[model samples]
Target: MIEEMGQQSLFNILISLMVLIAVWWSVQSIRFDLFLKDPEGIKAKGFMVVLTLALTYLVTSFILNYLNWSQTLRFLF
Candidate 1:
């Protein structure tokens, strides 16, 4: 169970990083109507989006762990 929780935490962190990177790429490369209309607004929107995702994932994982929902008999070995 401990091992599983560790792996899950690691996986969640990696996914969050990937999401942040994707958000960065989208914000940098795309010029959608909403974004093009206001550069500062677009920047703020992107920051909010990434922040929300990170916070949600962290909160959910914390709740899950607090509830002892970790899997058993799972290890990277």
Candidate 2:
């Protein structure tokens, strides 16, 4: 049980890291100049990137937890 918990923790960390990298890559690929034509454009872009990363992490974690819970429930039943 302890080993299984550790494995699940590691898997969650890996998934979170992957999601972070993907979000960063997507944010970096965007043409900020075309979208935010202002002196604060870079700041805006950074904020958006952070926001997106946070949201992605939240969603990914939620889905993972839900899946894990469902599997546990199946085993219980």
Candidate 3:
């Protein structure tokens, strides 16, 4: 089913969710005192989350051709 949607649409949707997750995760982390001392830590955490999600999507897709869990991100975004 995913293969029928065209790759560019899927790619855009994936990247957008990755970015949104980055923001949400970063805020949650900050709320938990993960970076209590330095205010700048929030920004850093957000960037890391975005990069992590993007890398995760790429690595998972590359290693597992049968996986199609990327759509879960769409609901969250």
Candidate 4:
């Protein structure tokens, strides 16, 4: 049980890191300075980015738990 818990935690961390990197890459690809000139618009964009990351994590975690994909992988290994 302890090993399973550890494996799940590690998987979650790996997924979170991947999601964060993807978000960072997306943000970097966008020309925010050219489009969002207004201070309020910039702030809103920042908030939206944070919200998007949170939602991504929540949705991915929910799907992972529901599917139990990690267990399947463990079995295969």
Candidate 5:
């Protein structure tokens, strides 16, 4: 039981990191130069990091919640 729990935690951690990186990578398509005073500046980079984190939180929450809901639904049968 302990081993299973450890693996589950590790899986969740890895999945979160993957999601975070994916979101960051996908966001690069946007043209930040059109909006920022200095698109390549430190502030622009920091903004991207913050925006990515917010998006990641929202996405991961939905994913984990869906998994939880699906697992619970199994009890209805």
Candidate 6:
């Protein structure tokens, strides 16, 4: 039982990291120059990092919830 829990935790970590990287990649093309006074500054970069983390959290939660819901469908019959 403990081993299964550890495996599940590891799976979640891997999935979250994958999603985070994907979100970061997808965010790189945005036009932050239009909004920030200094798009190339540290503050702008920090904002981007925060935005990526927030997006990743939301996306990962949704995906994990969907997977759990689907797994529960086995009881529908």
Return the top candidate by lDDT.
Answer: 6
lDDT of 2 by residue, 23-64 (tens): 777767666667676725678867776777787788788879
For each predicted model, how many residue pairs clash, with residues at least 3 apart or on different chains?
0, 0, 0, 0, 0, 0
Of 1 and 5, the candidate ranking higher by TM-score:
5
Q: How well is each residue in 16-72 modelled by candidate 1, as lDDT tens digits?
A: 676566655655655555645565686767865666577656665665565454453
**TM-score, model 4 to reference:** 0.54
Relative to the unseen true structure, what is the C-alpha lDDT of residue 20 in candidate 3, on a scale of 0 to 100? 59
Candidate 3 vs 4: which has more lDDT: 4
Please provide, for model 3 over 12-50, each residue's C-alpha lDDT reduced to its tens digit, 9 standing for 90 to 100: 668657655654565454443454455457776676666
For residues 11-76, what per-residue lDDT tens digits would candidate 4 score against the true structure? 878877776777667656656566566635768678657866886787667767866866577788
- What overall lDDT, based on C-alpha atoms, would model 5 receive against the true structure? 0.91
- lDDT per residue, candidate 6, 28-75, as tens digits? 999999999999999999999999999999999999999989999999
User: Weakest 10 consecutive residues, lDDT, candidate 3?
Assistant: 27-36
> What are the models' TM-scores?
0.43, 0.62, 0.33, 0.54, 0.87, 0.95
lDDT of each: 0.63, 0.78, 0.58, 0.71, 0.91, 0.96
Ranking of all predicted structures according to lDDT, beginning with the best and ending with the worst: 6, 5, 2, 4, 1, 3
**Candidate 2 or 3, higher TM-score?**
2
Q: Which portions of model 3 show Cα errors greater than 4 Å?
A: 1-40, 66-77
Deviation of model 5 at 58, angstroms:
1.0
lDDT at position 76, candidate 3:
81
Predicted structure with the largest TM-score when compared to the true one: 6
- lDDT (Cα, 0-100) at 59 in candidate 2: 73
Task: Output the worst ten-in-a-row residue range by lDDT, candidate 2.
Answer: 32-41
RMSD in angstroms between candidate 5 and the native structure over all alpha carbons = 1.3
**How large is the C-alpha RMSD of every model relative to the true structure?**
7.4, 3.0, 9.5, 4.8, 1.3, 0.7
